[model samples]
Target chain A: MPVMDKLKAVSGTAAIVGVAESDQIGRTPDKGPLELHAEAGRNALADAGIDKSEVDGVFTAGYSTYDVAEYLGITPHFTDSTSVGGSSFVIHIAHAIAAIQAGYCEVALITHGQTGRSDRARAGGNPGLPSAQYEVPYGIIGPPVAYSLAANRYMHQYGEDRTREAMANIAVSTRKWANMNEKAFFYDTPMSFDEYHDSRWISWPFHLPDCCLVTDAGAAIVITSAERAKSTRKGAVSILGAAEGHDHGILHQMPDLTRTWGRHSGPQALEMAGVTHDDLDLAMIYDSFTYTVLATLESLGFCGPGDGPDFVADQRTAPGGDFPLNTSGGGLSYTHPGMYGIFTVVEAVRQLRGETGQRQLDDCKLAMAHGTGGLLSSTGTVILGRD
Target chain B: MADGYNKPIPIPQPESDNYWEGTKAGELRLRHCDDCNQAYFYPRNICPECGNNNTSWIVASGNAKIHTFAIVHRPPHPGFMDDIPYVPAIVELEEGPKMATQIVNVEADPSKISIDMAVKVVFESITDEISLPKFEPA
Candidate 1:
């Protein structure tokens, strides 16, 4: 189906009823992944003014206490534990919509939490599937190296000087946004584009600033039908559109290093949301790496490929800029406890409700949130609006 | 089960059986779609572009370009602890398709690595049955 039609179908049918987040500012050495999940789940239920036992559907990505149904101690009529990299939560939202539309459940809860700070050893261990015993010996390790390769390719395709400077500008702009968000990890420590240029490289074409911060925390949200949402505790943030797409799981399978499935899925999402880029007041793009955000911006038609660096360099994405992106500082400065996709949904809801003090946009009507997973392998886009 | 080596053992599904066998034989293999005339890796049952199941495996020349890479000063896995500051790279194979592999015999310095630098594959024997493909400055 065409993107716009797909979007219109979901319009006003389902709304995010409540959004809540655990403390994301600092390390939480006392918590484990499951504990945070439960806390966030409870908080979201409270925000929705719904009974804890009323949630009949549970969805989660990344680390959880146990099976989502078991961890939350709810017998969900529908359950999804889809973990397709970091964007899993966004994908779950789309799944939840299908479940709700099908009458499988009246209310669903999506949650995520991680004690990435406490589990330093596991955090530092070779970052790959634990079951893949054959590939690790050859030294296919963590996410940084995997994404670095793509960043390197992007620099080669674009001019080296321009690519480096553009990415630094992305960091600088995101950090500037972070400065306004007290919850962001780097709220006080701001860096300039030039400083980003001079910072030591974690991988070729990527500075320290280009990488996201490893954080420990949890975030959760409650979703239901628009009618059910209105009768609940908080005002509903209606879901205009949601879509997910996959290119390939392994990096070796991707068609190109620079372009990704986002090229296809992003448009599909906007078309489904029945809105154009001009209609969007803010965008909360996943920022596992600075390049991912830049890449998605171009792929989603905000700009053309290789134009992301320059598009960001002119302050188009900064606070008060025409395109205010990552107002919560994104994963670059916010809590990136493993998979941070759920937080994007939370921030989008807060923005739509005009709940974000200081960081909120004037008369913000529409928003776009994107999540990426598995070596730039998959993309999930959710378009939200205020009724 | 070695302390520093967590080699990924292949549990071959029908689609990827040949690719795993090829890795065991130290030959990098990829699938060529008969309809689209395009090559792809991480072998799939259906051709991504043409949706043709009539695809065949072909040996790669092992020549590629450094699409991108990163130097890990901190090893996240205990298996990688000894290899602190190792180079993990994505190499775009000459045949098309990018592979995640390590770049050997190169400085881990960011300035030394350039995008699209020529690279060639080198096999590293992890265990008796597995010989993983890596890359070096070619």
Candidate 2:
């Protein structure tokens, strides 16, 4: 029983003392993917008031961990390059904590960046691998088509006005947050439900507004022992708990697209933290698509299988709403540079640390960051707390 | 968009040769696990369900229902420029394996496609070594 208690008490094992992003997010056409990683890493280390040499654990999904190490000139004793798509960095946080607890490394750095818009370095969709022989020939290539299949099915089983229209609420609500964020790509541009439905279709059931923005940006977070983090100049957010799991590598191969691994990972993550949904102050769910958020939210038990539409209706996730979701505008209106997962961590850390200027949640104590990767194929949830 | 249809062709791997050959012969086949009797797609020597190497192949009914579908206005690549506004779908074969395919012989409008709509497979020979199994209204 004592051993079980010890294992469960991972809340304060490690703390994120620093969170930073590359400068000039929306249109950094000059910088490449690696340059963005280097800048974000350097800036994050500076935020922690720590030196690059202090980083012994490196975690990244944007580029090879070895390349990240070389670019930052920090040779990490432990490295992770798990590329489950956008959710890799959030899932990597769980692994970073485990490695830190196990004494593999002290300070872990998780970084992500890409020139998804300007340079055509789009992330997530891996082409010409194994699935290519089967899926590619029929044009099951990218997320737009791959994920739209599931959305269309959900609309069919339920109803389009309920399911698909509910998805539009996410886009509109996300834009509402973007309007408040000076850094958001759509900061000046507001979205309306009518405009959302009228937008050109990339794939049926998913309009232009429903798709995530492709920008050039990078975000990173630095974590170390909770005790060590207390000495840093920045406020440290405790790593309460985190869990990661996957349903399928390829979207079509997923046995059930209606739900993701979030069903398992979300509960397991909250249980590890000894927290409940009621304890959460904010949620930063990956919004690669409106359906991505809905599918994950339902599976996380926030709503029933067919309840996503009503749950998000009336702009519940928008500003001045009960559920403060995607306070960073999410991928919908925020800068989604390939893998958007790391940015969610950055925003959650800021919200918990009370650093968010305008979109700050009052008396924020606990924040949830859920990352969905590979077209609802993989899910990772990390519960951060201000202890 | 290019004048020539330059869509990339699939080079058959050793394990998937049988499936490709079956498509060329105008027949749809899938691997069935002798241990678990689970039918799976994308032609592999080993059964994905039971991990049985001693799997047998069976000719599929080639009949499936539209599990889900999407009308892609933008092609993943420029090679598919000619095939814009196409409906790509995940169809569940009668044998229980889900295969990624395209729904053809239907109106171009997105509203025309519906889930669980009965469809059957048709072979399209892209090249000498490659043949694709497409689906259309039954």
Candidate 3:
């Protein structure tokens, strides 16, 4: 899914025909990552109305490609375990589409599951090489601290109130959507700017509401050649366009503090899909932190740099608003489970299929699913379409 | 400096041995590429810019500016509980490369750490083998 400027634009040849999540989300110590993967994988196969034997390709993040294959008892001709943090699954969709177009595989199944909270399997930070020498010495660090550096810089660049208000709105608004999702972990828990502002600071400029929930969850998406999707009884969500790129593996080395590879992949993907920001009916952005959403909204061209505050004001991304984002509650309130990239796509596909019961967007034609991994380190964008 | 530093310290790579050695001698050492004449941190043998093997260590002037920072209120590791609410900052060396280091010698106040504030390097000997280079207001 690495889209160099020289590569050809991605033609929409693959469609995600099925998407599913495990029966449980918040806590599942009874299920490990592999068990969660199998549960979601089998359910996704059923959702696609296809048999397990028909799958020719398999993809997942943070695990050996053979684990899912061996567990599900299928021999796939193609498999990818490209672990670039959370965005791996989004990148997998692009790779699966390319593989299908190249006839490397016929049907691709992508799976992700983690017991981040239940098993305490979450990594504090990258150890051994770079982060150890540079980042860790300062203190025990994690994504929140690294992300906070960017958010703190953003506040220094813009008006403090504006950026703070913007960050608060992102957390509050996402919770508003979570209020509509019965499955959301934060269901019935509404957030306001006052609560957000008063919340205890984890990292300066970040509060309890600012950070994503650490929960256990699993998700899967099944994609096939667009032509094959046309014959399925389920309405398919085509991969309109997709692109992936990395700016830096380490946060301090990020080229721009306020931007990410999203600044590039977002445009490359939209150009490939032949769509614009105005064309998107829904946006399922990875929200590990409130600042993450603000930075991404700017980088994805939804708003200008340092303009995220104005763009998110007055609850624009909340329910019954002009832009409906993270309708599945997102990682902020729904489920994070370490790598959240797949869940973003899962929600996008579900929304496009009109499977989101009460929080579903009306007449959703096109939606964008974007994921950020490793502190704005890797970014991937996938635009899905119903038509 | 404290004895028996019980933290996850960096194990010097053969490529970066010079950096750790230099830290022991109270110097901030970084790699320089002879091909492109660019200096960089986290010492590596090969020049990342020109892909040239003609790289060597050079002592840094220790002058820098705060690029950005965050005060970590929650300790992600048990080793850092005593140092909770620490300020971790990214600093820009006068020579152009940036690094991740803690901003010491001042209160870890959010309003105090303005971006681009002038800073200088100071060393804290973690163990007998390693002394970390931390930044403080110049």
* TM-score, one value per model: 0.87, 0.96, 0.97
Evaluated on CA atoms against the true complex, candidate 1 attains a DockQ of: 0.43
Please list all clashing residue pairs in model 3, or write none if there are none: none
The candidate maximizing DockQ is: 3
Model 2 chain A lDDT-worst window of ten: A121-130
Clashes of each: 22, 0, 0
Q: Residues B1-138, candidate 3: write the lDDT tens digits.
A: 376566678778777678889888999998998888989866787777788899877899999999999888887777778887888889999988999998998888877778889999998888878899999999
| TM-score of the A chain in model 1 | 0.93
**On residues A286-340, what C-alpha lDDT tens digit does candidate 3 reach at each position?**
9999899999999999989988899989889999889888988888998898889
Candidate 2 structure quality by residue, lDDT tens digits, A185-231: 99999888889888998988788887899899988899999989989
lDDT of 1 by residue, A1-387 (tens): 444655567766888987888744358888777778888888899999988799988888775424655767888888888889888989888888989999999899998887776676553333333224323444555566567667767877777777776777667778888888788888899887677877886655567888888888888889999888889877788888888888776665567778877777677777777788888988999988888887778877888888887788777788878778888888887768778888888888888888888888898889988899888888888888896
The alpha-carbon lDDT assigned to residue A347 of candidate 1 equals 88
Model 3: per-residue Cα lDDT at residue A274: 83
- Candidate 1 residue spans exceeding 4 A from truth: A1-7, A23-25, A63-66, A123-135, B1-40, B43-59, B76-85, B92-98, B108-116, B126-129
lDDT of 1 by residue, B19-121 (tens): 6678778788888887788897557768877777988888999999977776776554556767768887767899987667788898877788766799998
Pitting candidate 1 against candidate 3, the one with the higher TM-score is 3
Model 3 clashing-pair count: 0
